[model samples]
Target: MAFKFGSFDSICGQGALPVCPLLGTSQGIEPGCYSRNVDLGGTIIFQPGACFIHIIALIMTLIMVLHIRSKYTAVGRKEIALFFYVYAVIELLCLFLDSGIIPTAHVVYPWFTAVHVGFICSIFWILLANGFVGFQFAEDGTPMSLWSLRISAFVVWGVSFFVAIATFNGYASFSYTKPMGLFIVLLVFPIVCVAIYVVSQLILVIRTLDDRWVIGDILFGVGFFTVGAVVLFAFSVTVCDAVEHYIDGLFFFVLCMLLSVMMVYKYWDSITKEDLEFAVGDKGAVWEVKECVVPSSFPPSRLASLPPRLRVFEVVALYLLTRSVSLPPSLSVPCSHLRTPTSRRRTTSLRTEEPEDLSSEEWEETSTTAPNLLEETTEATLPRDRVKATEARAASKGSTTRTHRREVFGTKKERESLLGRIGFSFFDASLPLSFFL
Candidate 1:
């Protein structure tokens, strides 16, 4: 049967109201009515709001294509760029179909059917490309499983497209009728894929402490799409009628436009001025500091090697890794060096040389022995030997004085709290909670 907008109003007549679908056909007239809209090439074409959403989608696809082509040179990124170009082409075609620029039917019926099916396939391709891009950028590295994900999304969309076409042609039937069934499949599949990508992205952000710009962009896009999808799904299921459908379509359109603008702004510099390298370089520096400040990777056995006071600092360092803002370049370099095998061996050796307890006699002996040890070690043999010697001498003097003070007048927890205060202020200034949301 042909669908017409405002059909429900006509059926109700002037003074009468439409019955509620949820309250049963026998129930009194309800205040709201469903709109009658025809599905053309798998898109609802009667609603201007949906048309607007399609236009916004096309703009976003174009921006992504240009951004990737200009800023990224990696082999994997080039492949992603190609996918985006194809996505843009298909989206533009779908927009034309919805706009009636392309005729809905032809003398050869199968030709029309093929065009309709192609439209649905194109939408799926765009979604697949979007998911791939999110996954690629969120990881802050090349996707190792790029080929696998691409192949999987392609297979799913191909199968779903043919199934939708067959249903439209009456060759197949399902419990919910073919068109609705196809809609449900298409809607649910992408939602599932996007959800997985978002969760993976969240984990990557937490673990690596990457910049929020990339994470925030993906979250906003996915969040809007998800809300829009839920509303549309409810409308399609007959839980809500035509008016609800139109309202939801309007909301979706507005959200899509907002998402498009967000994407553009987030990548504007990288896209226009070829500054992705600089942005990535800054992110790398933060990631390096994050790795250094957290010693979670260290075994519990290693903690015993450090002096009691230094052990407390290690604990402080761990806490800072979790909450500190902007790790200094100085700390990052030493932390990286310490993680190396040779550097680790040297640390172990130094710990072995440290006395269990520092007495005045022990301090003098250690201080005299350090100079002699320095002379014995060749320049090549101990690249960091001089620095280590200087630091060790300072630590020895400090520990000896502190120990004497404690023995003479009972010690109190007199450790300076500057690091904690500095960490708090730095974190507050650099990352406000508003940025995360």
Candidate 2:
């Protein structure tokens, strides 16, 4: 069929060039090819979709470069560093070709076609590096595994480079030709590397379920990148044409931007507010009252040094006490110890013996018999001692009061203040105070 403007053949067969089946089948291929033809004087001569993809990839390259430059001194793997350097150079070259600054048709420029393919495949290598780096950081904030992946990715890209050179020189081209080389090196290798990296990261995250935010961030970043890569791959294949190509590129760009933002947010959120405030050297005043609250079986001091598991039990007991007047089952003890029958019998016998031993006149004269008079004489003779005793008792009471206040009120208040500053108010302050009382 003769070529038409919007028809697949017409767009792919611009500039009076022979129609290639590979080019013809690729979707979203038309706009880029058509645009390139218009740029090269109304005839399609080069693959526009491929050129556009490279240009976008070059932009991504610049972003990666800037990110690396911003964090150059950050401890990471050497292989990742090399990948960044090589990927940057390749992307720059691809940008030049896509911009049409490097003419491939000239015999003097016989290697330009091979160079273009090599650079195109290198974009995937960079993406793989990025994903691997993310996975490394997510697991332990280290980059050791990224280095290994980078080395493997480079080997894969190297093989594609030789294939690109051979194919462009009109050497034996198999059903697995330039595109296959590009797919294996750029698309397939990177996808596999990222998949492995992401899965490993997820396993680590699941194992360390203590940090939900980290897991969420990893999932967000990897999921976005995976979807974007899939869309880009579809564009690279013939399933998507000109308009779809631009759409895919835009989608990929958005996903990348979202991933970057998520990484930043996750890093900042990981730092607790107390740490942040301490870093700023802010020690604000705390308003609180303390009470003398002790554990049923042990002194409050004993509870402080208990192991984490025991501490958790103590906290639960305290919470239950605060919520209810009845002592928890864990604290319940027999009433016999509180009011012993033996002690009650001893008290009764003493009262009976004391009544028979005392006559009213002798009891009045005897120190033990006239209990009220004995108490009066003792008080009258030791007035100064009483004052000193009162002062000592007051001081001791004050110290005990402060200790109880801290145990009952200070900790909860401090925690509430912290949570409030961080914008979390799920637990009401009154609940803990009631428990302490």
Candidate 3:
């Protein structure tokens, strides 16, 4: 179906209108409504560059999905990463449609509309994922942002629904009137909103926080480039009319991959370590805030601060573990608190023990665990001489523990959001990316 440039004349033959290319409409009509690249002898041909870029992105997307599934344990980060994976798949399908691998028939409209919604969902998830990250950056355990988080997504989805209706309507009446105006509107809205959210968060982090956090910020900034790619796509569709150009999807897949991978590395470095880290620096408990719980071994301190939604998650996870739910083998959590005083200890080759270590018995008696509220405290008095000898050491350790606990409970590094973590250093980041292959 040959649409007259800037007009919907349908000059040659408007038979099926089989494909909706992101940039332009497919060429030819009916059984031969081909021309992703060329419609020669009633057969569609695809440009190699466009086709393979999509293929490469699809491959990368799958690799990311597999790695996250096998490695990362944080349910929140995992869900976000999965959304990105699904986003890539949807884009790949759209690429297939644009490449004339899938016929753009009237029958395909319903399915295509669904695919479009999935694409929107990908954006929605990214928006929320970023929102959660931003919230964590500024306020660790505050409950006030709950309404804003929900309302913001609701608004975006609500607008997107109307836009989707308009889009379908526009395509339905494509022959009668060009939906170019509405098309431009739909394309611009989410792209701008997402781009703005990511970039603004990065800027806010950089302005307010220290240099250590810049690594995650840089990743978010890289993710923002996906927005630029969307802008280029808008220009291509509206001005260039490069219907066959799949660079938009290509850019999105790659950029988002960078963002999601960077996030996984920062939040759950344990999974990405051996292959990536030369030395996993223990920056003291107070410095590295606990983001999520590992199902295999929940850190006693980290368990106390489970995000509101995951309050019951720890219970369910324990149930699963007891039932022997198979998990990808990873290093066990430092259950130093769980060990009995008399248990013989062996250290792993990779992990280094903290300095100023005490006997398991001594550590347990001195340590503070989550309160049951019912258990009565039984105090053990040390020998006066022994106490005097170790009084300074115990006091110092207690102070640090309390400080770390306070940091976990809505204090210290409150301003250090995820973006600041991204800007740590390039060499630090390059390690993980090197193992990504």
Candidate 4:
């Protein structure tokens, strides 16, 4: 069998150069010797080798689409996934067209072939757009970028489809004999898109990426694409004759194209990294929040050893423990008392009281009696005078034992310091504390 390039209707029967199977406007392979035509009832299936490969290619394209979708944070992920989706559709049509599942003699074959050609052209245009996506020409995954890619691809596909349909149906100037428009749309246009895409991606990899190995993927992809094209168009006849029609360029071409597409995915994946901080993944956002640790006597190394939840609690506890206790502003302690440690103890003693057994209501009443207590200490009194007044009050109340204990230990006799208030034995006063602001 031989290959022909003109129109689907003009495809001649088998003699020397068998007419192309895909609408005759595009390049297609004839049935090889190894192609076993199966008869499922009355229908004859042709080109099993090419059909199987097309199926494999379609499966690979779908897998690549899924792979592209998985990289949610990758730059141009949405656009590139769209590219694979289009390619998968193209491969699906190729399966029907190239495999002879949809025979050229069928009326719908021309329409499917035209649409296939259009998709091939459009998918390449989308690839060129993807190259610019890495440069951040527009914010990727945004409506502007996605819509522009979609609309432009649609236009490319529409124009290519028109040319193919016109050529196949012999409408307008696109004759079946000379399909110059179809040639440009199906062949030359894709070459241009591929060339531009490769150049732009090379620039991106060189300028933006640190690892130069990613360039190898691009090179490999280009090489595979070139080889696939050369095999399909230039060496198809040679290979067919050499193998005695057991196999043809179509098989090698599909395999090579699959490898090329895989390489494209690898190249894209290598160049783009996921923006995990911003991009919402399938697992959703996993915010790792930690309380801001202020500088303190506890070194960061030690603090880091504690659980994240406990770090904040320990910091607060340490803050209250280390700070010096002071009188309330309303109490009006004398300046002299604040100046000396001994004077501070004496002044604190005047305000301090024993932690006696009291009901919750009594404690609340005592805590709320701020005005009466303030009035009692309006004027500054000597420490000796205050001690005498306290002792006399205690003697009258018949609590001389409590008053004696207060005089010995000052204000701290019955009061638990802030350190004890936390009720954790982890704190050690002997440990060295360092503070950082």
TM-score winner among the candidates? 4
What is the alpha-carbon lDDT for the whole of candidate 4? 0.61
Best by lDDT: 4
Per-candidate clash tally: 2, 11, 16, 7
Give the candidate order by descending lDDT. Answer: 4, 1, 2, 3
Error of 4 at 428 (Å): 14
Write down the TM-score for model 4: 0.62
- After superposition, which runs of candidate 3 have C-alpha atoms over 4 Å from their true positions? 1-45, 67-76, 121-125, 137-162, 169-181, 207-209, 212-437
Residue ranges of candidate 2 with Cα displaced over 4 Å:
1-80, 107-113, 116-154, 170-182, 208-210, 215-437
- Quality of model 1 by C-alpha lDDT: 0.41
Taking all chains together, the TM-score of candidate 3 against the true structure is 0.42
TM-score of each: 0.41, 0.39, 0.42, 0.62
Displacement of the residue 62 alpha carbon in candidate 3, Å:
2.5
In model 1, pairs of residues that clash are 34-242, 35-242
As for model 1, its CA RMSD to the true structure in angstroms is 17.8
User: Each model's C-alpha lDDT?
Assistant: 0.41, 0.41, 0.40, 0.61
For residues 1-437, what per-residue lDDT tens digits would candidate 1 score against the true structure?
A: 12223232222221111111111122222323233456777855543454566677778777766656555433235445544554555456545543444443432333333344444454445444444454355432245455554565566556765655454444555311224445445445545655665666566556654565666666676666656544432333242344455433333534553464345335333222344554443233422233434222233334444344334434444445545456654333223323222222222111112223343353334334423433433342232443344445556767664443333222221111112222332112232222211
Query: For model 4, how does the per-residue alpha-carbon lDDT over 1-437 read when each residue is reduced to its tens digit?
Result: 33344323322222111224433445443333233365767877655567688788887877778777877778788989998988888778877776566777788987888888889889899988988988887999999999999999999999999998897787887765576677678767888989999999888877877999988998999999999877766565567678777566777877788898899899888877878677666775532212221222222333334343334344444444334333334432222111111222321111232223433443333323322322333242443443455456567778874655344322341122311333323222332222110
